[model samples]
Target: MDKLRTVSDTKRNFYQYHNRPINSIYRRVVEELMVEMHLLSVNVDFRSDPIYYLGVCQSFTQFMNGYTPESDKDSIFRALCQSIDNNPDEYRGKAETMLNFASQKSPQELINWLLSPTDDNGLQDVANHWRYALENPKFKYSRLFAIGLYSFLAKSDAEIVKNEEKFAELITPLTDKLSLPIDKFKKDLELYRSNIEKMTQMLTVLADTLEASKKKRQNN
Candidate 1:
């Protein structure tokens, strides 16, 4: 805790002269803190909430040397989503930044963010509403309804969702399998977890390919 505070304070002091030398001592401080966070994993279950999402937005903005465009809110939003999907621990420090400059994200954005980390089982907190909005979608946030539901379904139980449009053909039979009701959420979390794992694998493969290409080019 003291280390984090020391880094935070160091950044504050460095901000005064950082423009003159531009070494950005604070950047190193923040990165060290991020490493500490990776080791800690303090907030293991950060229940996909508005505050958490907004915090991620703030963290990116702050790390970019303290300038965020008014017009590029969507870009910032997407980056935040991607970062959270990448590292949940780094997101804890994000809360401070988010509290200052971030806006509350749309429900659909929230849902999609959760769904995109499909392989990370930590994100299943929002599953109950996945199909509810897909079928009904009455409110202003309805625009998010379909996309969120589809993302969730694709990562969870694609078969049920693929045929969900045929409410009679699919949802009816599913209503019996779980023995609860057709609409009640089934715990097919493996779908989301597998998706996240797949993404991690793909990223690893791409990174390896890029590194190999760089080495070959250097050798040439």
Candidate 2:
């Protein structure tokens, strides 16, 4: 039997990935948003609400980085329809409404909508409407929606990075994967480390210069 996991379990697992800077920051942002939403009386279920879940993912990605593949629009519409068909009781009206909205727009219009600035109230209104379709009340804060959007994304990205690290560990006969002998791999690693050291020194110099500027301004 498949064991059921709680939201706490999911959170704990995802927290392990926070060493990946982007995902870590994103998770913190999501956690803070969740707290704020609770304060505002918005009942968001990261575990159970599919609309809220996927809606969060969609809008959060846009908010963090306002770019969507041009290729995904049609496929997204199709998937919505399929989900609705599979569970008419839950998704029928919402799916149809989304389809209608999509049908009224040109492909470019849809792309523009996705690319719209996160700060734009109009863009948020559209995201809120999607959440409304799932029977949740309109979100008072736009940031809450972003938390929903990024909750899954942050974890997924972290898992990918973890898997990549694991793959590197399992690549035995490392020469086969690197297409170089072990000695060559060591040589390349040393060169890379030296380059990194040079970059670190440059950054240290920049930091010192900025600190000196701050002190000089204080004296003046």
Candidate 3:
């Protein structure tokens, strides 16, 4: 059996990889991500894939957009993956591959791929695994997985995802077909979108404030 990872181990690995203490403000983010990844990693039924990695990468990038000492962002990300004994590069590379695959297909094509198996290769193999997981009652579902599905939909049809009515129309039937918890999936995606908007607004305000301060200093 694999030894369970603890928060302390994550922190230690983070510090070691970063070569310094993480900022107090950002520490919570790291801890939360560490805990989530740890739980998913340990779950016997949980399978890590490109879609989930995309979710992790997207969430980390968006949430840490304005992290101070910007260079530390890469170090912190690397540390987070290394702490879990996973490769950050694999996450990034696979996610990019998934994104590229999604970009080439229509929303319906993507949905059809998920609903029915295709010839096994590349994205088709991923789709096959997703179909199997959805059918398995023991599959461990997480917010990260929900985000991954959302990301794929968004990539397949940006306009549909942008509109609430259209998005619901698209996801409702599919969720039902897969026996997923529709309410919970919708709720998590709603929260994710809301948090992202709030973060963007806050970043905008901070940028404006800094610009004003810089101008004031220049005028002095």
Candidate 4:
């Protein structure tokens, strides 16, 4: 059997591809993702599903948006997955596939599909597995999975997700159905969104500082 990669191994692989140190501000985001992915990869019940992949892809894209040496972004992403014995392309492709599928459905239709036990559609298998995991006491729940669930709802109906009351209404039924921890899931997503906003502001400030420094050097 192939040995599982450690967090240190994954970090080494990530840096190897980038060929430069990650910016201090963004290093936490990258390392957190690496650790999360590594933990999920090692968990027996944490299956690599489209929803989870969507979470991983979204988090990586949003957090690493302003990385320096823009050219190294793809390499960094590839190394992240490779280090964990996963494929970056698969993660991106699956995330896109899930989003596309969700986008084409109405909010009600998406909910129905998730609740349906019949395997009539492509999403049914994913739903089935999700339900199984929800019921399994041994299944590991992570922030990434919560983000995936949030992404699914956002993709299905942007307006509903934006409206606080509507969003809760939409989530309540699904959480009740799956016996999920509604409070924890919502809290994690809330924190995720808040952190994203903070990161965006920090990136803007960093960019402004760099631009000012560059102009100062040019004027010298």
Candidate 5:
């Protein structure tokens, strides 16, 4: 296959694999992240609270830093431990226990569990959660929450490139079309892309912070 065909095929295959649910029904990570943001909206004004939003970004990046396709049960558990360790004030008590339990699973399994709804409540799935979060009157700032969640996911994608093993795993598959001599160029490009992604994430946060602050001032 040509390079373009290879890229398309790879994406299609991976999407089919990653998007497939271990459970009978499929639940997307993006939807789950939005639901999580809605829950967070109860405590922080993603639209108005600059500091809280920055904290959200920090938390998102930290969590994503620990997670990747290459992540194992132990690494994920350690990441959860570190998060709880660093933010005892936020992640303590019953919440901490639940998170600790959740961390033992692989990333896919963990996501599946997160996207799964309670059996007793019949809460539906991740899509239902996202819809409820957006439509519920209690989540007045849900639009903002969703926007923040999208940013969090984007940042997480960029953060994953920082993982050398994960990055190599990601790029190695694309090498079928290239000559051996171009390997150095591919490596260079990987490093370049990683740096650019990180810088772009930083700029996005700064830009979003400024825009949010401007809107808040105007509303005041």
Candidate 6:
């Protein structure tokens, strides 16, 4: 938080994450950040509060990013599909960045980015990547980022609706993919009425276990 103290609102509001296909979701997240923090992000041009992050900042790097005209994109798409099917987590971000970027663009901008000439042997997976995201655990469990991912998914006719079975299926596979023990995610979501309630429950369990151990040690 201290890092925030030295900065002006303009800089913070205008902070751009320009590394495309890597920080693809940055534009949307930054936009949301500006909206959420709008009370502090003020401007005087119209004597009204500045709407920060209302738009994505697409750079002039269009021609240099993707595959050349002659390169075959077949193998990358196959690999992405296989990796996602065998285990979704392992391929979490393989094609998500451009999907996020394309999703957030306006129609004209979208057309421009799509039609831009390829720089070199661009991975054809660019065409199939979002389709992969549509089929993975990332599509279901990544609700927090669905808005960012949704831009692509929406265009692809993908759905990320709230569903209980999907939620359950998503958490378990995702937990294993990340090598997280299933019990941990379950434990984190527990709610108690108060801190004291949680403390009491923990103390009671700890005391009973400790007492049983004391008896065992004494008997031994």
Give each model's clash number: 4, 3, 0, 0, 0, 6
Off by over 4 Å in 5: 1-91, 119-220
Give the whole-model CA lDDT for all candidates, comma-separated.
0.36, 0.37, 0.78, 0.77, 0.37, 0.32
Better of 3 and 5 by lDDT: 3
lDDT of 3 at 55: 87
Given candidate 2, what's the lDDT at residue 75?
Answer: 38
What would the per-residue lDDT of candidate 2 be over residues 1-220, giving only the tens digit for each residue?
6445444443453345322323332344345433432333323432223333343333333333311343433333333222212222233343333334444554334334433323243335444554343342332323323233223222323342235344233332322422324354344434433543664565568679989999999999
Give lDDT tens digits, candidate 1, residues 1-220: 3343343443344343222322243345244434332322223322333232332333334333322233443333333233223433333433333222212433234335433423233333323332332333221221112222333333334454555354234333323332322232333323433543564565568679989999999999
Query: lDDT at 4 for candidate 5?
Result: 28
Worst ten-residue run, lDDT, model 6? Answer: 46-55
- Worst lDDT window (10 residues) for model 3? 120-129
Which residue pairs overlap in candidate 1's backbone?
118-192, 119-192, 119-193, 119-196
lDDT of 4 at 37: 90
lDDT string for model 4 (40-142, tens) is: 8888877666667789888888888878778877887887888787889878876886788788877767676656534554656555655666566555667
Error of 6 at 98 (Å): 3.8
Cα error of candidate 2 at position 73, Å: 19
lDDT of 5 by residue, 1-220 (tens): 4222233343343344344322211123223333444344334322222212333444444334423343332333233223212232332322333333333534334334333423222224333433343333333333232223223223336554456566445434322222123345445445434644775676578679989999999999
Candidate 2 has a TM-score of: 0.24
- CA lDDT for candidate 5: 0.37
Prediction 1 global C-alpha lDDT: 0.36
Return the clash pairs for model 6, or none: 66-122, 67-121, 67-122, 68-120, 68-121, 68-122
Clashing pairs in 5: none
Error of 3 at 7 (Å): 2.3
Q: Against the hidden reference, what TM-scores do the models get?
A: 0.25, 0.24, 0.85, 0.83, 0.22, 0.22
- Pick by TM-score: which candidate is best? 3
